[model samples]
Target: MKTNFLAAAAASFVVAGASVASAQDADAPWEQSPFRCEPGETYVMNVMVSGVEYWFPVYEMFKQAAHQFGCEADYTGTPEYDVNKQIATFEQALAKQPAGILLHPMNPDPFVEPINRATEAGTAVVTFAADSPNSKRVSYVTSDNAREGRVAAQQVAEDMGGSGQYAVLENPGQDNHDRRVAAFIEEMEDNYPDMELVGRASTGQDPNKAYQAVLSLAQANPELGAVFMPEASSAMGAAQAAKEAGGDIRVMSVDVNASVLDMIQAGEMFGAINPNQGTQGYYGFLLLWLAKHPELIDPMNDHAEAGFNPMGIPVLDNGYSVVTQENAESFYWDKYLKKRGTRGIEG
Candidate 1:
């Protein structure tokens, strides 16, 4: 019955033109109906480096929530880790005129204009994993990057017995990565002074650059106890470099891909600080959804007089998890993909 009704409705709507659509969309009482999307409403989850495995689980949950709301959802971004390219892709998504966008901005300050423009154009934008704090984006969702760094630091320091030398590989311009690296270094300075941060290098999230950085750092700091990076892409190469240079240097980083999990299980690298990506997507969609339909709330604020929506949540911490050798098997991408029976981020 529901299928037949939808089919019939779609057929009737095809004959009605822009005037009918404008009437339905602008003045219809959508809140009186079930919490579902109106026809033609769509949302998108955008990110940089579209090919990475880290985004798959996030989008899976995003897609699930969009389905529940009877809305269209798409995953889009630049395949390369280039900010200008990513911004261009973001603008392309904007051109589709989606109801909302859940974006992972490649850089913070650079996204201010785009976010503001989207907001002014009445398309809700929510950021995830990374943020544009100064933007007009409705909400920013992700794990606590500072805490992730501190946690990684504690694990690495403990593994190294709270003594000896350490180094860091970084991607300097990215907000979340910079926070993690700074917090990791600060945690060491405050908690474990004996663990010296002897070297620093910018890998730009490239595995080859990370490999070369670690190789040189190992040569310079022979007593290096552990090396840390902000993300798992670099962790893979750092682990390999540490092994080649003399497997004594423990490697620690944030996030876990399939290969990172495999390495953790094999004891080639230490654990990772993995964000709760599922929650990131789920709540990110919720925020975007609510932000778009601000008519649902009439809060006890000056929103009506000021002409602003009542729904305003600046930040949402989706939380994080530690993936170590003990839990590495459970965190494997293949296992999760197989259990869920999804094509991951490809679709």
Candidate 2:
């Protein structure tokens, strides 16, 4: 009887050992894991408006990519709109010596030196949503801002029958915002000659400022048919002002949030251009990781002569979608993720 008990215990031990080994193998990094990053190697996603809802999915995707490749990921930045403060936060992130960084620079000028410094320290960096072209960052990933602007303008102008008075709510200093505004204006002038731009006001990153700007513009240009802003924060206020003014002015902009999606669904907004933010974060990390360890994807020829450096792929357009009332339900980040069988940040 004692011999039978010992044999059963040994069998149980072997089964437990096999279970442990299976678990470890399941958690092992994928075959293509870049650099075979050391166990503690970390990556970070840094941005200016860290608390914004639009960025939640971006960071979530970044985290998911890190998890897949067997690395740690973190988020750090300032909620303020100050470029200097964002630069300071960036420098702080650098002190951690992360393996790579994904940055959403608040302005083009302030990030040039910090990005160069990070790259010099052998930390890979990639810019997304906004960029510093003069910086030595590995790559810039985003929707084509100029094309998004042109598309938004075309949607509004065509909806208005190609003839209407419109006003712009601008965020003047941001490189991406400025590009969108410029393209919108050019599209209007060249394609919709009947559309007149009556006024321009700087909202800078404030929704209240956008609200007041729209109110004043509507007062001045009572015949205004539409108002376009480079981003969605301003759209919330602009929609409210248009509703309060009892005007038929259509509100259009770029980017999406729950509020903006709700507005579109209720017909309070004309439409929005949503850049594939998840793709931006996922590929941004891929670029940064590749830049850190180019050996993972070596090519046959010298890349410099081929004009196709692996570390930096130049600009990658993640593409965009125009969201209207008919399809606004499909663009909310959380709902979109749920439909794909994935949980966002919290998961």
Candidate 3:
């Protein structure tokens, strides 16, 4: 389904409105008797890498959902980008016996054992952004990564007059990033034969690495028309390099932060794909809560399954938008929240 970018941009406020409106009515869905969390029960959001500006709105929306459901949510992850460290942290969180977990696994393989243990121990697990499909995780939530890549490819190729040399900055070994880069290349090969992929580099979530990569790529391929990355951190550095190199190479990426938004506004970036991060966090918690308390939703089902049967292992595509200078201001999480009259995490 095609996403309504403007509506998706306003969705967080719509959720906030529902929260406020639900507060006044005694029969509100959130106030229903069956879905309440037990005393002392809490939820946790875990990621392999933390400390990026992109995660701030995600955790804020997660906290908002937890508050609505009368539960607490905490964030835990390693800043080192090591899958082993993340697994250790996940084990540590599991030891506390949280009501559920929202995980963003860095790699699919390293998380299988931990997710299985969490499921067997009765903690509901839902992955977001990145997924571990082989594990017993109940659900996975994310924007359409392949679609993001195709959209970026089409936009860049069309802007470059359907024929130009391009390069990709990849975050290697991450499934989501791999999907995006793969789809981007596939789209270019299938539709834009003239748009040749001149180079590929592994930036690995570091802006400095991306900066150097872009500079090196440009130095080697002076006729390079565009560059694409799966996330914003690399785009930040890539944009700076393009600026220093006479602003001929266009940069495109997925996800947005203040710096990326500013770059777009300043015409340093071609565009970006913005996933529904608020929905990822809010519904991620909802799915985990329902998985933990299947009885709450069992009335709608005829099956006689009992005790955390995972409800269903559904994948949710939260949708995304291609953000350009015309609407770049509205895509900023802070500005979106402020315009919606909702306070951010600090507020």
Candidate 4:
């Protein structure tokens, strides 16, 4: 009886050992698992960006999409918006030999060569937020910035009766802000001929500078019908300046910062063009996923049959929102503010 019991115990031990080995094998990295790419099948991605406030929502969307297809994604970037630092981060991400990269380039031209190298080496490269227009990236996922500029300008023009001196509190030489300013100017020139763009001031995305600029503009030109700020932080300061100046100057700006929403509801500012933060994250991921798993999406006839990239230059207009008094309450800030005790669009 003792011998038989020992024999059964030994068999059970062997079975348990086999189960543990199988579990460890299953948990191995993509490079080690049997499900891993045979030679070039595994796909890994890196998302390099600046700060969490301005662009993190977009990256979060991309992160979710990566999970859907069982791929790995890493998000890394400089904390303080340094162009050189961001470039270095991109270089480090490339060193990992990732299958793809989603980059929000600080300098458009400097990133061209590195992004091209990644593309030429069969790495799928894509841009979001700050796009490198000349890079060999797969696609860009962002709002139609020029349209947003035009929309904001029109809102200002309507508020001020299509005529009055207006000024732009800009982000200096950034591509997105530059495009927005240009579009705003073009819209004013083409449509609202009566409206005059008095000044184009560079605040460097600083609230203090933005406030000073708007204050000076308001003081100098009481006829200053509207002040257009193409950033959220600047918008808050600009609104404060307008209030301090104690004049009829209206404020219309870009983005949905929590403070901007409060200003809108309180009638301190006109409105803001709100791009959906959650959607930026949701669709940015979808594009990255499609770039990695080309099989899931149908191929375009214009592209080659043997090629894998079938998305065919798909431009997603994630679209924008104008946060005005009429629908300010309907915006999604209440839940976020209550749940997180944090301020984003709620501020």
* Candidate number of the best TM-score: 1
Record all residue pairs in model 2 with backbone atoms less than 3 Å apart, i.e. clashing. Answer: none
Query: Which window of ten consecutive residues has the lowest lDDT sum in model 3?
Result: 1-10
TM-score order, best first, reads 1, 3, 2, 4
Q: Please identify which of the two predictions, 1 or 3, would achieve the higher lDDT against the true structure.
A: 1
Clashing pairs in 3: none
Q: Model 3 off-target regions past 4 Å? A: 1-32, 297-310, 337-347
Clashes of each: 0, 0, 0, 7
lDDT of 3 by residue, 259-338 (tens): 99999999999899888788778767776776787653334454565533635446777778889999998878777787
RMSD of 3: 4.6
Candidate 2 structure quality by residue, lDDT tens digits, 224-312: 99999988899999988988888499999898889989988988888899888887787777677767776544667787576444656
Q: Which regions of candidate 1 fall more than 4 Å away from where they truly are?
A: 1-34
For candidate 4, lDDT tens digit of each residue in 1-347? 44234334333433464465568886655444322223433333333334435454555555555554456666767665567777777788777777777777766888889888987776777676567888777777667789989998888887777887888888755777788888988999999999998887888767788899998887778778788877787888888888888846788887766677788898898888877765665555555544654543454475565543664344555667888988877554555445646443212
Q: Is candidate 3 or candidate 4 better by TM-score?
A: 3
Report the CA-based lDDT of candidate 2 relative to the real structure.
Answer: 0.83
lDDT of each: 0.86, 0.83, 0.84, 0.69
**TM-score for every candidate vs. truth?**
0.90, 0.87, 0.87, 0.76
Error of 4 at 212 (Å): 1.5
Q: Is candidate 3 or candidate 4 better by lDDT?
A: 3
